[model samples]
Target: MTSTTQQHPLPLTGRIAVVTGAASGMGAAIAERLAADGASVALLARRTERLDDLALKIKAAGGEAFGVSVDVTDQSSVDRGAEEVRQRLGRVDLVVNAAGVMLGAPVQEARIDDWTKMIDTNLTGALRLAHAFVGDLVKAAAEGRTADLVNISSVGSRGAFPTHGVYSATKAALTQFSEAIRADLSPADVRVSSVEPGMTATELGANLSDEQLELLGSTFAGIPPLAPADIADVVAFVVSRRRELNLSYLVAVPTRQV
Candidate 1:
């Protein structure tokens, strides 16, 4: 199969992008894919080592990428990271709010701390980056260039699942936030989109308890999950489109994920 890197032309040449949670999983894949499509990508995460390693890989692939150490939950950290990205990559034309956490537990057993963590990272973290980078996005659009903000949501946002209440809430809120931002930014020619993916194989749920794991295992037992690359491909397509079409919302799931 021809890889997306090899298949997609460089539509994002001269563009700059920021991707949070870029140390691994879909964030890493999206960062690499964006670079491949000819954007200079900034990889942001708490793990400097992983971000460095991913940056090296993108550079090896003839794509431009840099690592920025950031804790998405911290506003000051996000501010610093955004400034660094501006310094390093010039200006941000695209931003991906991929930093997120999923903690699963029954409502009765769920810890308040876990709920707080989810709300902070998944919702507020995304909001912070958006707030910090709006000026850059608006500037790019004003300069006759297309600017984009892509938020990564989840299938859980579409419906309720046992032990996934808080996680689902966060994602659903993100989707709504994206729509509102899209409307608000339309006059500026800055595009906003939400990408919701389902049942992808990633470490997102690695922290789940044994019971949660068992439930997931039984739920997805014979079904194949979407790869990180699959979702990345969709993201690249959305952001790469011509400015006339918004390509606002998408929900991609494994064919068997019903």
Candidate 2:
């Protein structure tokens, strides 16, 4: 007698995913990876051109993708972006808040503007996105679908670094926030995860001042930083876990880093 069993491939097939900061770096890589896993992805970022380019690339690869301009720091922008995703992809089953800024400097010498930008982008921006999509996440989970909220934090959140005072503070706040929300949401089966990545090769540090860069460069001297795809892989693993499993907090750093 032949046994009959259903074989399913592609874990995220038919899932609708919304990724912020999808125009570049880890965000872009995560969006692409999710699409490849069979999710219809909505790419959100202020850079419309880059989002368009990524969307096109995903489509060419036979994956579903839509690009939308979203400034996470702006409540109205986030709301509008959420609406666009809902209209284009139906209810969202996954939300990844990857928008962040790392402007490092000695606290005394730091530009107030830089601190504000980090707080707004790295902390409050994540809150905005969460607020806009928590309902959908809860509903999806209640309906027995996978629902995930992933926040991209930093290893800087775990300790003090010479020039990363305010930056570290913001990330620390984000990490704590993720924990608090996870407590509230996990009971509903909505997974909330914080991904804290250590030194990574991305445009995240491109805007740093020369002094800060030199300081960071020496600090990470011989260690090869992680690639965006590495973080993307972690995210994919987290969201693809079984419904009963939730990898809540993950810190990903280079193997050689102390």
Candidate 3:
């Protein structure tokens, strides 16, 4: 008797993925998940030590991974990181822009520097990454491979929060930019997606002022926060879809969140 059933290869099996902010939190989770799914992952962040630690763990788990020191706030840094990924891992077919900062304070009391940091990291950073890798993504798509650019936005983009004005603005801008680029890239068979998560459990708020932290704690007092792995799962699902299908935008939140 001939056995007919056969195992299918992993969806991302031969793809190359790059994840920014990969030292911790959502970015780290996403990189790990992608690598486990069979893609060669390049972890990018300013924290070289953390990235190296993550790379070692991924390799130990039988996944291919390498760490690259990248500061998304700097164009030169991003360009260099992209070059390294290309030279080491081949053309990138998956790029996840997950680097961000959330420094919350009352509008009137908000430090100008905080606002600048947020804008530079959460908005311009995403743009720098997209510019550095869009060509590779396009080439991958043209070669009949699944190509994706996923941006991590936030539900705050659509709702008003007491002390998250600037943060929300950056996310809102990200969402809009994601949509515009989707339009431009869809014709080339490149999938672009914006994933908005609500109240995820991560270090995104570690830099908040004590008062703002208190407010943040109270706002989600009873609602359980989503985990980084949760967002990573969403991203994996989005990119694993058939090349002809696109999950353009998604909002992920805990059920307890109103």
User: What lDDT does the true structure give each of the candidates?
Assistant: 0.93, 0.93, 0.95
lDDT of 1: 0.93
Off by over 4 Å in 2: 1-7
Clashing pairs in 3: none
Q: How far is candidate 2 from the true structure (C-alpha RMSD, Å)?
A: 2.0
lDDT of 3: 0.95
Q: Is candidate 1 or candidate 3 better by TM-score?
A: 3
Compared with the true structure, what per-residue lDDT tens digits does model 3 show for residues 9-128? 887899899999999999999999999999999999999999999999999999999999999999899989999999999999999999999988888786899999999999999999
Q: Per-candidate TM vs. native? A: 0.96, 0.96, 0.98
On the 0 to 100 scale, the lDDT of residue 199 in model 1 is 94
> How displaced is residue 204 in candidate 3, in Å?
0.3
Worst 10 residues of 2 by lDDT: 101-110
Q: Tens digits of per-residue lDDT for model 2 on 157-232? A: 9887998888899999999999999999989999999999998999999888898899889988999999999999
* Deviation (Å) of 136 in candidate 2: 0.2
Off by over 4 Å in 1: 1-9
The predicted structure with the larger lDDT, 1 or 3, is 3
